[model samples]
Target: MDDRRGSVLVLTNLHDVTTDIVLRVLAARRVPVVRLDPGTDLLAEASLSASYGTGGQRGTLRTPSRDLDLTRVRSVWVRRPSAYDGPPGLDEHDRRFAREQAFWGIGGVLASLPHAHYVNHLWNNRAAEYKPAQLAAAQQVGLLVPDTLITHAAQEAREFVACHGSGVVYKPLWNSPYRVAGRPHSVWVREVREQEITEAVAVCPHLFQARVDKAFDVRVTAVGPWLSGVRIDSPDLDWRRRQGLMRCEPVDVPGAIDQSVRAYLAHFRLVYGAFDFAVTHDGTWYFLECNPNGQWAWQPPDVTDAIAQALADQLEKGSAP
Candidate 1:
């Protein structure tokens, strides 16, 4: 048996809502966890103290900063770091350093350390951010994918729209957060008609794809080696389009699809992924995209429990979680 004593460190910004659920699950398994936000007041005293302490020596864990021996940490779950808008009462110069430290200073230093099983390493995640790369990777793994085009020229977009007839959909390539009247607006899947493409292409390079007339939606949540498959059905084109009107069923994932997903995860070096799929009327499954840090709490409670259990098991085993 592999014997190692360590605590799981979750580095996430304050806005993340999943931390509570994950914490509760880890707590239930008696796994120790420390939450660190680099944006907060850096407890240099505590960190320096911990850094100087002998390895494996019992010490009081502090807030904002805790001594985590790289080798001992079983896993790390990194969500976005807290946005440092500056401390309330600090001078501008100090606050600037604080903000920089959150993402570049301590944050960068800690991430560069050579230990711990990360959910999705920042560099890997950054590399996988390009849609073209993801599509190529998905296709290489033998997953059926829809025909897509990424273009800035209006003529190219027009041609793509015409080729798909009424079966085309447009989405943002980078998913830049958009605002309308100071409120966030999400892009919804809609039928792309030729008439709608007049000047839209000139505005930006949009991602257009053949909109699959899906028979159903599938969300495959992969955490470590575990997979939780959920079938989503809705009258709308996209289940996310009408949130409250969708139905979900716990289903067994096909072996091939599961294998493809596993390969996809490995290719991206991610321990967790929320993959969206479109099952066609002909029974073929088409991969849409994989969200490295997708939301899984909304899935059935049983599914959540299963994922949480899998994560805990991985962490306890000192493997990827």
Candidate 2:
């Protein structure tokens, strides 16, 4: 009965390959899609107007080339938060302040739409991105979780490693993108040697975990009520560290695992997620983490096709697809 309904909204970076595949599927399916990349679009003549009162907030987003009524949007897929940069010629401090302003200003409005079925909503994605929260939810759903600790004290880290006789691994609190010598750098998950826990640990909080003796990695991509999984086998500690070197095969997820995954998604209020598990030789699936809006375009051919089709279905059919 609503007159303001409109196209599906996708918030993602321009270079996201998964977004590209899904967009193509939506195009072939004749589903209306509005793509917004905050990094490039937010400041370049993108407009938003929201009204606040007793009935709550209602608004419209206007790009230079199109208009989207917030109340009309079928669904929103927040793939990633873009970089907000200040205008040219500002000092470092002033630039940061301006970027902050841009982030809150435009981002706040997008986050306030009155009627929309977001695949992984911004607020929910933010919460589920935390590893601790994910692990807690996994345990509650009867999934085995590795013993974990988040600390900055070297002594505490050493003690944790000693207590966890199976040995321990170190992971970044978050995979924050940065650069070194003007080139991109990243922190990959790797095992920790007791002697390597040095004074540098005091620099910031670090995540340490008991290493799971794994047979392989399982990546399950959940799209609404449907689920598909792939087993990853590689010589590297983190298969993603050497993407092309890893072998991927379709996995038949057990009913129990499927139910627990559904539970995890419900706990985070997400319609889509990429769940990672470490499978032991004994067939135990150890929960590692979940990416609310993970990459899928690079998966094997059949997996990619299924994912794209699933996303296209969701966009075309709205809440039920």
Candidate 3:
């Protein structure tokens, strides 16, 4: 392994398709790459400054007792890293110990490094997970936002719902695992009734907002300044729910919305964001939410290819010149 040049480190789910897109781009450029699941022993070893890096197409990435030469590391891209699936043979206590340390350790090490241009710093990502923070940021940048209320009291929720009408909707305060019949599930947007608000707040502070009556949904993929994507039309309140009921077509993102999205990314110090927006019957655009490290590979191949290219461009531009 050369000490002068470094590789791109991707923290991602093992089966993630976008991982291949990124890896291929770097390989095409002859840039060394290191792709690893956050849960692996290799991550822990590297985090603790133990010797690492066995050579492969992913290249020579290692951590000796010596500190990593961050100046050599051009950039780091963190995708969706799933929770650790512990190695077999450990008791529950040992498993917990490893998992907990691994979680904080990786972030701690990466944060302390001086020169790595994180696509989106992990700490910033963690803080931006709050829906309120995201909404506030959007509003600060002059983007139109839907009427929203967050409350733990049921009566407060009822009052808000009464004002927003039956078109009111409920959303999770944080990203939660959805499950049904002992299996995984995903949440979809749906209209709520006054009766549906029954005992909802007793569990926790549920997020309620006026469901914008929309002509279509706009997905904004921001890779540096290369923001692009299409508007999607679907009958379902949540386009995600109507996967088979929708149509997508390329549409021009308004300049004001584009500027606001750029400011939002700058506020969070991120290079990429998958943003959701609602375009109403009158053509009014409302800010929905931003997924900092959201998936872009699911879009059409040409879009995915452009995002990959933008990322590579950043890596090369950030390198010593």
How many angstroms is residue 242 displaced in model 3 relative to the true structure, after the best TM-score fit? 3.5
Evaluated against the true structure, the overall lDDT of model 1 is: 0.75
lDDT of 1 by residue, 1-321 (tens): 122367777777667777777788788888888776655534433341223245543223355445655446666677665555655678999978766765564555555544466776767777777788889999999899999988878788888888875489876677678899999998876678777787757777778889887889999999887898999988988788777888888988999999999999899988888899999888889988888877787788888878877766765555533
Candidate 2 — worst ten consecutive residues by lDDT sum?
1-10
lDDT string for model 2 (235-288, tens) is 988888989899999999988999999999999988889999999999999899
TM-score for all predictions?
Answer: 0.85, 0.93, 0.87
Q: Write the per-residue lDDT of candidate 3 for residues 1-321, one digit (tens) a residue.
A: 332266576677668887788788878888876665656635456433422346311222354443334445667777777776565578999888877776676556655444566777788787777899999999999999899988888888888888875379877777689789999988766677776677757887778899888888999999887899678888878878757788777779999999999999999888878899999889899999998878777666777788899987766555344
The local distance difference test score of each candidate is 0.75, 0.85, 0.75
Off by over 4 Å in 2: 2-5, 53-57, 319-321
Better of 2 and 3 by TM-score: 2
Which one is best on lDDT? 2
| Candidate whose TM-score is highest | 2
Candidate 1 pairs with clashing backbones = none
Candidate 1 ranges beyond 4 A from true positions: 1-3, 40-71, 84-101, 319-321
